[model samples]
Each structure stands twice: as structure tokens, then as C-alpha cells.
Target: MKSWPRPEVPTITTADFQLRLFDTADQVIKPVHMPATGPVGMYVCGITPYDATHLGHGATYLAFDLIHRLLLATGRDVTFVQNITDVDDPLFERAERDNVDWRHLGTSQIDLFRSDMENLRVIPPQHYIGVQESIDDVIDVVQQLLDNGAAYIVDDPAHPDIYARRDATPQFGYESNYDEQTMAEFFAERGGDPTRPGKHDPLDALIWKARREGEPWWDSPFGQGRPGWHIECAAIARRFLGSTFAIQGGGSDLIFPHHEYSAAHIEAACNEPRMAGHYVHTGMISLDGVKMSKSLGNLVFVSKLTEQGARPSAIRLAVYASHYRQNRDFSTAVLAQAESRLDTWMQAVRRADDDSAARTLIDTVIKHLAEDLDTPGAIAAVDSWAAGIVGAKDASNASTELTGPGALVAQALDALMGITL
Candidate 1:
């Protein structure tokens, strides 16, 4: 019998519509279609840049990086934009806690994050707009929201933050599937004090907040203060990715207030359908079955992982070993397994002599990747081909076909999983 043909490229299949794991149950992500010959646009919510980049951060960025790479491999043009939230409430608190200037802290941590991205071989996005640099744009967004009556500045004696009142916008809780009544009840149960001086509603978060003691300051129509944590992304995404883009992705923790608020901000600002076509959120990385936390003393730094002799490629492989949407456990053992698998795939790639068969195998993988990024399934296909060759009852056919499929597998795996040997 003739030997089975290897895949044409490294990708997932479009025919496969596997359930995309999403934290937002009612959230529906529509595929982006571009007039030109490529993907429409992609925007990912970025970090606040305080602590050293950790395993959880790596998982989130790498998952999207892989998605970007796979989209390009499938012959789609992609404009990937990830923002840098350099000014916000969190940055203020962190800077105060450490007795550092807010700008200095933001700059320091942003650089560290860039280094982490470089170390992990995560592709640099075309746009990395920082909140401080984009203050004018954020101000513009705030002004628009105010004009639309979607935002109102009120004084709070207790909290004193300039709030975007929930009562102002009918679409306030639309993204999170919470009606007005539900939102009021939700925040009330959680100790929301709407009557505390200036707040119109208990659920209102800050759009542009007044400068607090020991925090950052930027001049705006509202006051001499900085943008709020959630407003930065909302404004930055509008400036770079426009009202609606291809996909918006980040950690699942951002789903509620961060992402949900961004959705409202965009709608109130632009009167658009949705901020992004699809919403993709990755699950957190856990250490010892607990979510990664510096407070819990279980945070694992990606840089530290390398210092302890973990290979960069292996670290990436360990990250992608499971579905991008699944919660991944960080362990040295799993990383070792990743390294071992790479070695096997590379060995097979090196043995192949036929370029035609290699190309065919690569194309097969590409098809696999396009199917909602079915990486695990794609890896399974490669492994099955390798296993067939090794366990084949026939010798001559095995020897001929094995080399090509094996070589192609390594190349394609690198394209999708960043596994290079």
C-alpha cells in the first residue's frame, strides 16, 4: 500500500469548529473579514506593568502571538495592536507603595515587560500605545462620553474619584449581561455606597479621576490627574484599532469590569456594534493548583525560570502544550516533556530528504491551525504520522515517507508552537 501523505502546512483546519472556551458565557465573537487579502485587525488588552513578568503573563501574550503567526502563515494580513497601560489607579498605588515616581515606575516596568517579550520570542506588536503618551486621545474619548451623557463627573467625599455613572448610559451593563437593576443590586451587595457624596450610581468606575496624594498627574478637562485603569485601554483601542477590530483578547480576569467597561466606553463613544469582532480570553496559569499570586508567594517569573535552566523554546512549548483557553499548571516537569517532544520532532525533520513531501506536510499543518487554532489536534496529527512510520509493518515505504513527514513536522511545529531544535 502507498504511504499516507503528510500535512500540506502547519495550521488548524477550518472545517473543525471546536467549542472555543470562553469565560463570558453570553459573549459571541464574530470572525473578522477584511476587504484586503488578510485578517481585519486584532487588539489585546495589555498589562499595568508593575511586577516582573510571570508565567501567567507569558501564557496570555504567547497565545495571541501564536494566533497572529498562524493567521499570517495562512496567508492573511494581520495588524496586531497591544497597548501599554502606563498610567492608572493601580500604577499610582504601586508607585506609592514602593516610594517611586509614577512615571519612573511605569517606564521601568514597561521596559521590563518588553524585555520579557523579547526573551520569550513573542512578536512585538505594531502599536504599543502607553496611556501617558495617549492622554490626549484618552481625553478625547472622555469628552465624547461626556457629550453623549455616557459619562458624568461627580465629586465623592469618601472616594473622591471622578466616576462614569452607570445611570448615564443604558448600555452600561450590556457587555456583562447585567441589567440596570442587577448592576445596582450586585454592587450594593458588594458594599457599594452610591450615596457617598458625588457618585451617581454604586457601579460607576473612574474615567478620569482627580489626582490623589502620591499618585501620577496629567492635565485633562476633568482635572489635573491621570486616566483610570479601564479607560486607558478603551481610549487606546479606539485610537489604534478603531471602533471595531478583529479580536480582543486577554486574561479571563479582565472579562468583567475591564473588558466589559471597554465595551461600554466604545459603544458610548462611537455608537458602534462591538469593540472587537471576537473576544478571546486565556485562562490563568496556576502554580501548585493555586492561581499565580505574589501575595500567596507562588509567583514564578519567566526570567527566573530561564535562570534555573529552563529553555525558552521549552517554556513556550509547555505553555502551548494544552489548549490556549485552558488553565495551565506551571511545572519544570511539563517543560522537560516539552523539550523532549521537540527533540523527537527535530530529529525526524533532520532525517527527511524530500522537499516536496516536506512542503506538503507543512501545508497540512497550516490547515489544521486555521480551525480556531486547534493546536493540540494539529500536534496529534504530526505525532500520529511519526508513530505510523516507526511502527509500520513495511520498511521501504516507512523509510521514504518518514523523513519528509518528520522534517515538515518540526518546521510546522516551530511555526505554531515555537518549538525549534
Candidate 2:
């Protein structure tokens, strides 16, 4: 197997912020200085496009958007690639329930998701691929795995299936820190058919799912089947970025089967030591105390919030107010607080004039964000800066200090966090 060209890793440094990354591979939070001589390859697992964009989805993407902005702000070019699992089981199930063509359903929902992301000012990825469109690439990967004895075809009465043999890949769960029981639980929750008979191991995931009676199918060397959920990302990322890349990121929920299996499949295909150099995961978003999920029937859609006259900026702020790695509860109170904080920041930006103070605030924000994307701390610092500016304005120094610091803070917010004031 020939290895693809790898991007040159450069040394990155922020003026006042020391950027640190929490490497899931090593279970350590350490300073990251990998600057990009070329574009930094970033692959984020995207939505399945089966349902509306919810708060959980918002938080995950916003978390990565923050990282994307921070990288750009610190002078690193990024080639971001996010894959849409348009051919997944949930999408087909939803389409069947809605009595609509699966393709049409996916297309409409993806449009809605794109609208929501755009409204929130989230940067679009350089390559946004769909599984159906990348069938060739996926098929090629599966063939490689088969040839290398990393994958095998399982005969099923209904359909022929190809599974990635977990036993063949020693690094199957390298990215996941969960124990066997916990991993099994999450694996089942996230579409892993763990107990399915004939797999080399219960954890072995499907690479190519044989054609069913009604589901979409593609012509492949294996048979008339569709690519599995995990294989699509590995294929697409490899196609766009190469065998090894800078980072692979998604919601923490994907750390188990999705990310873990994807990494295994990629490594198996390329015969490489690593797929992604770093794995970054964002925390889950819970509603009240329970995790907000479509399965739980407790979803706060982005469309609903926008329809209720809530600003997209406020929604983004609500998600950004908490650390990306910490699970946050969604509530009306949280949204209200975010709106209020955004208002305060906007007012301060309008009145800020102290360049020295503005520089100081920028440095403080950078420091907070650079430390493993500590958004809450960074936001707190900004709130404090805004409060002080407001106090100074009330004390009659408003005319001179307001504009400078205000503008600087606004720019910093936009640059560091994608929060436009």
C-alpha cells in the first residue's frame, strides 16, 4: 500500500495565548504548537441529516467552529472536511415514516442544516461529502481492507454484509478510553450491531451493508450494497486530506464505535500507524438533566428557536458559554443569560475606546480560549471586561476609552470565537 503525501506540520504560536489541546489518544491536555506549512487537515463527523438541527448538533459544530477560528486566528490555514451520513439507517427509517424518497428527505434536511449553520455564522468545510456520492472511494477502501484480511464478507439470508474484523485491527479502540461494558452500551446506542451473528467479534462493525429490499444500493465489487456509517468518513477523509491528517473531531458521543472503527478501517486500508494525528471530541448537550437526543424525544431544534424569534447569535452564545469538553444543560435560563451577555458585550463594544484596555482584554480572552478551548472562562473574562467598561462609562470616562477597547473586543470575539458583535 502506497502512503499518501502528508502535510508539513509547522510550529504555531499565538501572541499571548498558549494553545493547548486535549489529546484523547494520550488522555492528556498539552500545549499544541503544530503550525501549518500547508493547510491543516481537519475532518469533523457531520450530521446524518435525518432530522432537524438541534441544540446538541449546534453545540458540537460550534465547538469545532471555535477551534477552526482559533487556528485561523493564530495563522494556521485549515482544509476542513466534514462528511454527511446521508445513507444511514435513521435517514432511511425517517424517510419511510414520512413516506418520502430517502434522497429527497436527506436533501431537504441537509438544506435546513446548512441554513442553520449559515445563520449561526459557522464556517463551511472545504469538502462536505455525502456517502452516496463517494461510493467509489468507499468501495475502494473496503476492497483494500478485504485484500489485507482486515474485512470479510458475511453471508446473510436477506443480504450479503461486509464487516471490519476488529480482531484484525489491533488499534480498534485506541481512540476510546471506555471499558468493554461502557463501550458496548454506547456502541449499541450509536448504531453498532454488536450482537449480530457471524461477526469476528461483537464489536466488529459493518463496512458494506448488503442491499435490502427498499434501501438505496450501489454497484460494488462486494455486491449490490451501500457503504456503512463508519467507512464513509474514513474514505472521504482519506480522499481529501490523505492517509494521516492533523485532527479528527466530532462530538464525544462518537468516540466509541464511529470514530474508533473509522480509525481502524483507515489504518487497515493504508497500512499506517495512525489515521488522524489528534482526536478532539466535544461534550454532549443535555436538556434539563437527561441527554437531548432524537431517541429520547427531547430535542430543541435550531429552527424552533429561530422561529421563536431568538437570535442565532444568542443561540451560538448559549452553546459557547460552557466549556466544549463539559456536558452542558440547555434551559430557557441559559438562553436568557446568553442573550443578556451578548447585549452587554455589544454595548461595551459601542463605548470602548481604551486601546490598552482592549489589548489587555484580547490577551485575556486568547489565554482562556487557548487553554483547551476554555470558552466559559474566556466568556467570563469578556463579561468582566464589559462590566468594567460599562462602569467606566458611568463614571464619565465613556467618550475616550469606549471606542478603542470596544472595537478591539468585538474583533477579538469575532476572530477567536466567531461571535460577531
Q: Model 2, which residues run further than 4 Å from truth?
A: 1-18, 33-36, 395-403
Worst 10-residue lDDT window, candidate 1: 1-10
**Backbone-clash count (model 1):** 28
Per-residue lDDT tens digits for candidate 1, residues 194-288, read: 45566666677678767777566778766677777677888888887788876778987776667777777887788875666567788789886
Best by TM-score: 2
RMSD in order of candidates = 7.1, 4.8
CA lDDT, candidate 1, residue 101: 89
Candidates' TM-scores? Answer: 0.83, 0.92
